[model samples]
Target: MDFRRTSTALTREQKLAVVSVADVKAQERITNSYEDALIGQYIEAAYDYLAGPDGWLGRCCLLEETFEAYIPNPGGGFELPIRPVVDLSSITGFEVSDGAGGYDPVSAALYAKSVNEGFGYILHSGQSSWPISIGVDPRRYKVTFKAGFGAADDVPSPIKLGIIMLASHFYQNREATFSDNRITAVSRQIEFGLRNLCGRYRISRDHS
Candidate 1:
């Protein structure tokens, strides 16, 4: 099984800020906007560190995003790589004829989607199974879908708070490491706190 993001045009607007600049300032107890720009950078950095497939959470947080999954000779059913699937756009099976690839769109009536825990699965609608591929193409089966928690407001409070905490930590500590050893302990504490808040939502690599 192979899974990859099909949509490459994710706009900055769609990558919604999990926490606002005002939110970060409030967390850090900043009175003025003297360093608002720097704080904003911290917010973006924090968001990047904790969101999407490459982030610590290994899951989309702010909004739904499209992804494509491929399965070779899928059986009765197969799991969707991304969790909490918002929608299943389409499913296609590849057919080989005379040493050429042909498209075979799986009809909606032949399959159904079910969410178990956070994982999404494409199951046969009735007792029937998925069509088998004729060749050795790895991309025999294709599934396109969108997955995410929804919008910024739909994101869990703990995740929002975690982003704020991380950004605040970045603001407080300008340098990666201070000469004083005490700051290291503080950084570790903050790291652990962020993990505790966002850990449960993190998707395990094994799931991928």
Candidate 2:
């Protein structure tokens, strides 16, 4: 996934600070353009993997996007998915369309005060009938929302540290992998370190 933040969470100076390398020429061994690019790549990858609709760990912010949810046709009625959504900061818009081509905006009065529980929402106004779309459309309901911690500063300390640690590890071991693509000790160490941070914001099995 493409990250909204274009640069690494940790700055070049910050990476150098982490390793205590002050000389510009010596630091170029790890802070060159190619290495800087790799560091940024790893930072985004870690952020994406940890702050998830899938994996769990980091905090994110200033994100806004639209998502679609398909209403399932059961013999009884429509059912929404109960899984914990990833990085769903807030649901700003909820609208539905009729199978034929008409659309209607769902009123907030029909549901609770917009509380997001377990990354999903449940209407509390006792209304069960939502907009429906028939035929082959998988997503009849559209939701626009934002996710993340709010800004880079708001990200948890552990997650930021994890990103720094992992990026530094990769930066130091440019040739950690072999021609056969074998993982190196440095890679394993960073991977192991990341595991320690993965559970920070994990969704529980019983989340509601």
Best by lDDT: 1
For all predictions, the C-alpha RMSD in Å is 3.5, 7.3
How would you encode candidate 1's per-residue C-alpha lDDT over 41-149 as one tens digit per residue?
8878888888777788875534666677777765677787676664443232322222245556776677777766656788877756665546587777677777777
Clash tally, candidates in order: 0, 5
Q: Which ten residues in a row have the lowest lDDT in candidate 2?
A: 74-83
In terms of TM-score, the best-performing candidate is 1
Candidate 1: worst-modelled 10 consecutive residues by lDDT = 90-99
lDDT tens digits, residue span 23-131, model 2: 2224345534544455555555544555444445422221222334444322232212322233334555556666566556766655542334325453446556544
Which portions of model 1 miss their true places by more than 4 Å?
8-16, 87-102, 125-129, 178-180
Q: How close is candidate 1 to the true structure, as a TM-score?
A: 0.81
Residue 6 lDDT, candidate 1, scale 0-100: 71
